[model samples]
Target chain A: MNRLFTSLAVIILLTQTWIALRLPKGFYQDSFLLPVLLIALLAAAYLMSRLTQLADRGKFWQRPCQLAVPALFGLMILLVWEAIVRGYDVPLVLMPEPSRVLVTLSNNLPLLWADFQQTYLKAVLAGYLMGCGLGFVTAKLVVRSPFLQKGLLPLGNFMASIPIIGIAPIMVMWFGFDWQSKAAVVVVMTFFPMLINTVAGLRSVDPLHADLMHTYAAGKGQIFFKNQLPQAMPFIFNALKLNSTLALIGAIVAEFFGTPIVGMGFRISAQVGRMNMDMVWATIFVAALAGSLSYGALALLERRVTFWHPSVRREH
Target chain B: MKPQLKSLTQTQGFAVLTLVLGILVIWYIAALLMNGNQMINMLERTGQSWTYTQVLQGAYSIQRPPLPVPHQVAMELYQSVLNQAVTSRRSLVYHSMITLESTLLGFALGSLLGILIAVGIVHNRTLDASLMPWVIASQTVPILAIAPIVVVVLGSMNLTGVLPKAMISMYLSFFPVVIGMVKGLRSSDKLHSELMMTYNASRQQFFWKLRWFSAQPYLFASLKIAISAALVGAIVAELPTGAQGGLGARLLSGSYYGQTVQIWAALVMSALLGWALITLVGMAERLVLRRRGLTR
Candidate 1:
């Protein structure tokens, strides 16, 4: 089975190489050819599977086959996307091919890097920290004062329901068309999630634990730190995880309103106006990379911090 | 226990009192700072301003920002609706209707597509393996980046009108529904499936009787999110096309003319529209869930 799988991979690569060689120079230059080639590749794969005597070792090949299917599907999509645009002679202004997008990224690396620094490094990071910190503090305050819990929770809900687009322009007006405005939007976007999650987390401590702490004559601060805070870590981390994505999105979209010619959102909107689809795609690629990495890092932190939680324990 | 209950009630009462007092104090201070005479004078001054910049600066100088004071906006809004010719030029109500037409159309199309894709994913293992990841990756390419390309491509095809804008909304709104519906459909427990199996139910019956019913809450939650997303998508769609009608167009024009009041009024209207849409869905959810005895 292993041998058969190896042969199949070899055949697929060789076929692709042969097809690449047979095509006219700059065949990939035309996006439409890519889709046609992809379809042919899929057909070849089907036929290869039929000819190969791999049926007896089906279970053995299942895991590799499972992995291969998604990879092939992704490759096929890119191929078709490449082909259709090329063959149809679709204007580059409409949809640039993935290869062209890559070229644009490399060619304009410095500008992209600068936009990244302005938006992600300044606005997103600053706003995320402040919002999450304030939310945490407020949650603690509200826990201590039932009056606050009653007054604030509904207000937060109302605030959360206000769409980012609605407040973003207003924020731009208030904070000016700079990173400050974007950060303000991010702060608004991140605050509610953190507040709600932290409140829930603090409340998540078992009454029995609280009772024990009370019996031990622990002070309010001691009880909170020793019992409630530890219990709420998982929920707090969940909010943080959510806020990471929200902050990135908030920063990017906020830049769309009125920005000073730099930032991911500015580049995206500006480039689209210039009919530079490739650069728009490139900016998106960087944004996606940043969002995913931040999310992944937060997830890692959650795992580390909440290692004592049952959910983490079960995974191990 | 009585003391505990009394304390709880007092605390709640205190909280409510504080909130009310806070609001009253803010309002009172604001009113005192911008006395009625000053407000009238500012309004009178703003009315005399001709250039866009002057009007904007006048509006900005006011305590509450007079660009579009409540009454001015109300008058404009009334005029837009009543004076149909206003829409032909750049009326907010007229553009809102144009945008709404596209938003509703896009939302319907996107919801249908999401359900179909979800159904395919739920039923077919190969498709589930191959398509789900790509669907996720598709969102990685931001809609803002993609909207213009879609507009240009569709425009070149001579497909002008609300459909192109609606298509953009669909692209933006469908992902959430697909993800939500997929999660909802899979929420049926093993015991429930086994019970259906014991009843000799076919695959279709099993799905209809169990999975579909279980997915309603998730579908509703997703619909709330999707509908707002559709509105946003419709607005963003207008940005690229430079379309002359819709709320997006109104916003764009408002920005160009420095009609800060007009922009604020339009924004408030959109927010109200969003709230209304969400509320409508929530009402439907309540009615449906109530019928099913699922409301807690």
Candidate 2:
């Protein structure tokens, strides 16, 4: 039955794509055909969903199905998106098709790479390191004093709630119109989350384990290193993963305020003004790729560093 | 007197006050140092000899200082919020209202949509398998990067003002709520489910009487997150259009003209607004929980 649903989904998807391609240009625009096409798209989505459900029934196809379900879902959506825009003859400025975006992406590789370097390598990397490092240090300092923790925790939570990115202009004014300002914004944006997470993590050490370490005549440093730090690993990595995305966003949005000629945010805003939707989308594609890649890399590192942790161990 | 002083030191409010005072002192010194360089340069360019006290005095009031002193910022904030007419473009209150309108509207829509989607996902196996992954993946994309396109596209369709900005806010604020609500709705345990089954409870009855009540804490927690996300989204949306009626525009105009005080004032206002919004959500949570008899 699962195999049957899988074949049925594939058949529908292929048929839809082929029919969409074979149709005359703008055939569905302002016609009854548009509704029919939409219904077909819905049908395709429904079939794909059914196939996913069937695949979840057994372990026989678990690995392949796990990868296939999302891939097929994404492909179906993209195909329908392409068909709709082309069929409707939508203006390129309003929404460019995926094929056009890919073409523009390939053509603008040098420009995109420079933007990536300016935004990611120069600003995001420096700021992420400094911010996370400072946060960890602050958390460490706060962890030892109950009075300080009580005061700082609420303060840190409040700072986290503030729209920290609103400081981008002030940062630009202070640091000048370059990657440095962007880096400053990223630092501020990423700092409080890291501090809050690390504080929580460090305080999460098991009392029993701490007492055992005390029984063995363990010093403060020794207890922290052997027991508390290991317990804090998962929380630290959680903050790291969250900061990766936040750092990228901070750098990009800061660029929107003021920047040198190159950066992902600059490209996006600049292209939009020119009514160049494809270039805008291409930059977005790079950003999405960078974001997902960094997130994936951190997840891998977390699994490696916290292998003894239950969440990671449970998969085995 | 000694006992009173000792008791004051033990309180959390006292600690926070001490920390904030410490921060202010550091900020003052840092501001003096940063602004002093440019102040000395200007004085030197004019060939006027300056003393340390003179430079320190100048640093606190220097226009467009590299770092505006806290008092300077507070003064600007005070003037902008009170001195100007509330409807005037120069008024921070006007800009804040424009931004707040969208933030509140988008937050409402996003929460509704998110709750609906969570309900659908919980009841359907296929949606759980396919849509859940996409929902998570959607956040991994820098959705803010598309703010410009959304604004421009919607503008072309003659949808202007609050709706476009609100849509961006909705996109962002929905994610946390969906994730939270799905986890909340599924949080019912074996004993409860067995009891519901014994009662021959319908799906709606099980959901309303059991799952809904159980999900309250998670929903409120996520609501706090969602409101803040909505505020950020509204501000970012204002950026791309370079719109004239929001706090984002105030920041942009300040940057353009080198008005550091204005930028700082806007920043402070937005921070206050965020605190207020979160506090409101927290209050609502308390009220709801108390009504449900879950809290005393």
Candidate 3:
């Protein structure tokens, strides 16, 4: 009954907003009713979400209902955001509306695409591969020697703890103001997480597997290749996923220090001087999209590679 | 992995020493390559020729190098951190305190927020279903990307210095705490939760007595990660502000003038700051865990 009442109230409030939004320009322009309409819409959305939450607890509708709750909440936020920005005549410089941001994103696709290519394709991918490759090889070496594990791991941690901001300018000095410098920053930022994870993963080899290998008189090479490496795949992928985020962050921030003509960070900082709020929002959107997609891809790849893991089994 | 007070192996000690020395050696080599070129050119300008020893010495002792050797950086750090009075603008300790103030403040605020959110999610099913994904998505949006916007927006509100930087620190620090805490809060066994239920325990009673206690390890683990992250955030915030103080400003100015030794010194100071904070948290963790009779 509460859900029904809330739903009814939401529909009524939304209709009122629609009416207010559609009212004659002279009536709507100078009136305070728009904020009132938006406020009501926001409240109704909130109550409706509470209703949806209660509704979603049922087993039969669990999946779709689970999706609905957040979707509704997000939609409500965007709706109110759009309405508030448009209604208040907020400065385009201060905060561009989502619609304007979308328009800028669509209109300037070529610019954003170039920035993405520069930041993601050039800097992130190369750095990620090199950093992870170094870390993996180093982990293999460290696994063979207890001394390396004890010593180099701490050393790597120390190197990693230094923020990318500190290393980025130094990288520009070393590699110059190209994607190479950004990539170098990404490499340094990513290297230690991969190292730490791979080392931990190496230790995750099952003792039973080791015992079985010993029974077969397996050499170190055979044991590592057949048992240890395979077992470490999940942890290695964990680092890869983590480093994806770090790599993007490092590349972008490095661009802020110095960059070629085109990159997300360059565009963001440059355009802000011109008060191009739409462009800034668009860049942030692109970054968020790239970050999420990279994480999602890594997750998907992890599932494929680690199908034997129990967590993977739970999916199907 | 635990190093005991006794039975210390010489190999382990030598391994660490050798690694440090290796890094120093490499730094010296790079310094010679990068810094020596300028020195060599200077010598040429003065109608003089130099050999390898001279280049090496010049690399180490040059007023400013593209890459400073370890000793040069160490000397600079000594001059800034030890010789300078603590109140001096150039003293690393003075700047570090500026950064640390914001880091600690942000960390405290963020941890409180994360814990509050985690507790809400634990108790309220709606929040778990709705808010958790948003929290995850929030972290995926690079904090660095929005940091400038945050700085500008908050700077316009007549708020400056610590609060804006603290906001960034809070952004970086809160995620781990929420994730760690949620996982920990949910880790209570079915039997244990059932026992609490059977005793007619209130939700508040169950949480404080059962859930929060169980969550201590996760909280501390997250806190360790979060506190170090807060320092990083504070430093990053300092970068865009062109501020008069803090390690980031020191680094920025050093780089602007090609004062690589000063940059390296500032870098070293920031590292020490991170190390000190992490160590403090570790000590606190040990004390709390010991008091709780939890040895992990």
Give me the candidate number with maximum TM-score: 2
For all the predictions, what are the DockQ values? 0.26, 0.43, 0.42
The digit string of per-residue lDDT tens for model 2 on A180-224 reads: 998899898889878977887797787799899989999888998
lDDT of prediction 1: 0.73
Q: How many clashes does each candidate structure show, in the order listed?
A: 11, 0, 0
Which regions of candidate 3 fall more than 4 Å away from where they truly are?
Answer: A6-68, A140-144, A197-241, A299-316, B1-14, B37-50, B187-206, B209-214, B291-296
Model 1 misplaced regions, further than 4 Å: A1-38, A41-70, A128-163, A190-247, A293-316, B1-90, B194-202
TM-score of 2: 0.87
lDDT of each: 0.73, 0.82, 0.80
Q: Rank the candidates by lDDT, best first.
A: 2, 3, 1
Error of 1 at A171 (Å): 1.9
RMSD of 3: 4.6
lDDT of 3 by residue, B32-92 (tens): 8888898989899999978888987777787877777787788888999899999999899
Compute the lDDT of residue B149 as modeled in candidate 1. 70
What lDDT score is found at residue A92 in candidate 1?
77
| Every model's TM-score | 0.73, 0.87, 0.85
Give the distance in Å from residue A94's predicted Cα in candidate 2 to where it truly belongs: 1.2
DockQ of 1: 0.26
Please give fnat for model 3.
Answer: 0.34
Minimal lDDT window, size 10, model 2 chain A:
A307-316
- Candidate 1 C-alpha lDDT tens digits along A1-316: 7567656655765555554544444556643545546556665455334323232247786666665666767666665566555545567767777778888899999999999999999999999999999999989988788778888765554455455765677678767998999999989878977887789779878889999999999997899889999998966886786577668878888888899989999999888778777888899989877876787577678878877754354310
Candidate number achieving the greatest DockQ relative to the actual structure:
2
- Candidate 1's displacement at residue B40, Å, is 18
